[model samples]
Target: MILLIDSGNSRLKVGWLTATEDAATQTTANGQTAGPLMRREPAAVAFDNLNPHALGDWLGTLPQTPRLALGVNVAGPERAQGIHDALARHGCPVRWITSREQLLYLKNRYTEPTQLGADRLVALLGVRSRLPSAHPPYVLASFGTATTIDTVGPDDSFIGGLILPGPVLMRSSLARGTAHLPLANGQVTEFPTDTHQAIASGIAAAQAGAVLRQWLAACRYYGQAATLFVAGGSWPEVEQEMQRLLKQTGGSPNTHPTAYYLDRPVLDGLALIAAQPDPLSF
Candidate 1:
């Protein structure tokens, strides 16, 4: 098994890709579209209080020890070290992916190219690999703790990106910042029937509006249509709202005919990168 991990701001996403017949199907089931869909699901996943021992113990129970472990972590090296130590306990070698100058198509534009978060790098890598069109740019929107909007030009250049608070953050911030808006818990109800719905609507609009604006701007500046892929914890919950926002904002011409959400896109993207035959060896 090849282990893939994504350590985001609030949660640790662990995935394993086993060498088995069911791998493809399982990948599809994990909110991933296998084959041409450009993503996959981790064999298994867990979320904890970010405890290394708990994570390690969980991985230890898997059917087999992973031979290669690849992941992108936002928690920085200290937390990554803990994971490395734990994986070592199970005899699984770990390799934290790096953004070298020429490893992949992403030409980093960050002030410190290497300083970019692994999750963003992996997501960009996957986007470039899957959509290599020379005319239309690719826009990647990650809607997790904070919604991030990054773009890769038609020439496969990694320009910078924009970031804003995510849905949860938007709701929580509204509740905290305003007196009338109560804390919006995680419950889905029909649109604004009262103050709560109005609050939810406002929060949802803020979150979705950011995506729509960025997506449309990319389309306009790039001079070609763009593919918009949305993935994050809140995406499933607010997909329809996002779709409605997209339609209302009139950015579909720039947005892809279909938007996709992959089960473990960052992990799957890393796996795809790892699968490439080492050019150095060849």
Candidate 2:
């Protein structure tokens, strides 16, 4: 078994995969279709700091020790070191992933490819591999601690993307920067009458607006409606607002753009990468 880990700013997501399985025969337990190599459900743990004991306890539940371990870390150098140490204690040698100029059929368009986050690149690769025949100009909107709307051209090149503070981060920033925002805790509405609702609505609108803006740009660039794939922890709230905005703006009736919700895109991407003949060569 190959272990895949996505150590992001807010959580640690881990999964196990077996590349030997035929893609045609495998089914994902989460109701979403399984990728070519994923063999089972992934597990997630939230963390504000690196806790090796907690991670080790979770690792203890694995069916068996993974023969090969691979991961991508956006949690900084200190946390990366901690993860490396924890994996070593569990008898798994880890190969942490980094952004690359080219991998498989995908090409990176970033000015400095390595400066791009591995999570974003891997997520694009996962989506591309999962829907190889999908019409291009694709937009991937990931709503985690920081929201990102990344684009892939018709040629499967990772063009670029937009990033902004996510819902919780936005709320927190407002509370911290201002004297009396009180950290918004209310529902999103079309016309928010109070401060709490207004803050909630504003945050959702900002995220939704970015997604729609990118979708429109992708459509124009590709000369056709582009597909929008949403992922990450904050996707549910962001998607709800996106749908509402699309309806309000009448952007869906004629365009009929496709949208997919991927529950564990990072894990899926890591699994696909691990299945490669030389997983670490990249």
Candidate 3:
């Protein structure tokens, strides 16, 4: 069994994959295809913080102890180190995912490619694995604490990208940095009629608009219309807005970006990396 853990800023997405030769067909309780032949095993987990103790607890719940556990963490070095230490205690081999300088048909151009966020690298890696020959390159956008846009050129080079404040952060900044704005939970359904909705919607619009603008600019700068991918915690709220803004700007709405909610891109990337060895195994 392989344990793929994706530790994000707000939550963690854990996926379990088991390898066995059971010819018997299986199905989820809901009758969804789930079995070895189908390449699926209904996996579950408990919600926990980025704490090692919480992660350890989640690991303990697995049906069988994992022989290999790979993690993709975006919480910085300190948190990643802590999670690594805890996983090691369970005797399950573990590795932290890293950015690729030249792998999966993609070359990283960051001054220090390794310094790029593991989450971003892993996400792009997964994108590249599927798009080995995609024209115009791949554009990855993660909507989290801060929304990020990373461009992998048509030739598979990490051409770098831009970042802007996320919707939540933008709203919080306005509520905190300004006095007139009252702190309100981000729950505006549509454009608000009052000051609260006005502020929240404005923030959402700015974040979504920035993402749309940056993606278009990246397409122009890269000389190819790249495939856009969007992932994050609060993306559902702003995804429509992003699509709307992109279409309004004459960009193809279908190419606005695809949203991945439970995706642990780094973990998926790690799974891919583990399948093949590279310069940096970890």
Candidate 4:
């Protein structure tokens, strides 16, 4: 089994897959069959108060020992070391993934390719692997601790994108930065009357607006409607608002773009990367 880990700022997501199954074909939403195949459900653990011994004990309960372990860590070196130690205690050495100028058919367009986050790069690869060869340019909006909207061209190039504070972070920032912001805690509304609802509404609008802006930009750049793939932990909180915004800004009557909620896209990408002949070499 090949173990794939996506260690993000807030949590760690892990999945196990057979090397052979990773190469097997399976149809995706775009009707392609080249995406990564998971042999088991992925598991997540929050970073707060994380206990490596508890994590190791849980790893020990898996059905079988993974022969190879691959990871993309955006949780800093100390947390990465903690993950390595946990996996090592269970007899699996980790080969953490890093950003590269190029990998497989995907080309990095960042001025400093290595400075790009590995999780973002891997998510793009995951989208590419699942999409048909003729798929249009696409945007990936990840709503985690920090929200990121990355663009991928039709030819599989990682174009530059945008980043902003996620909903919770936005609320926290407002509460801390200002004297009387009370940390918003109510459902979003079209026109909020109360301070809490107003804050909630504004946060959702900001996130939705960013996605719509990127979606429109990708469409303009590609000269066609582009797909928007949404992922990350906070997606559930903002999905409805994002969908509403997508409909509102779709422009032409006949040119509404497609949007999909791809669960654990980073992990999906890591699994595909792990299947490569020498994934660590990149």
For residues 232-275, write the lDDT of model 2, one tens digit per residue.
78876666678766656545575444456776677767777777
- lDDT string for model 1 (1-282, tens) is 777778888778776655552333322213555324323333455563457778788876777777778777788778889999999999887777766544465677778877777688787776565543454677777888888888877877777788888888888888899878788654344466777677677667676677777777777888766677777777765676676666555545653344555455676566666566651220
Residue pairs in candidate 1 whose N, alpha carbon or C atoms collide under 3 angstroms: 31-263
Q: What lDDT would each prediction earn against the true structure?
A: 0.68, 0.76, 0.63, 0.77
Q: Which stretches of model 4 miss by more than 4 angstroms?
A: 19-51, 251-255
- Measure candidate 1: CA RMSD: 4.4
Give one digit per residue, the lDDT tens place, for model 4 in 108-138. Answer: 9999999999889988887777776777788
Question: Candidate 2 — number of clashing residue pairs?
Answer: 0
Q: Estimate each model's TM-score.
A: 0.79, 0.87, 0.77, 0.87
Better candidate number, 3 or 4, judged by TM-score: 4
- Misplaced by over 4 Å in model 2 are 19-51, 61-63, 248-255
Instruction: Name the lDDT value of residue 135 in candidate 1.
Output: 41
**What is the alpha-carbon lDDT for the whole of candidate 2?**
0.76
Model 1 segments more than 4 A misplaced? 20-51, 76-78, 98-103, 132-135, 178-180, 185-193, 249-257, 278-282
Pick by lDDT: 3 or 4, better one: 4
Q: Which TM-score value belongs to model 3?
A: 0.77
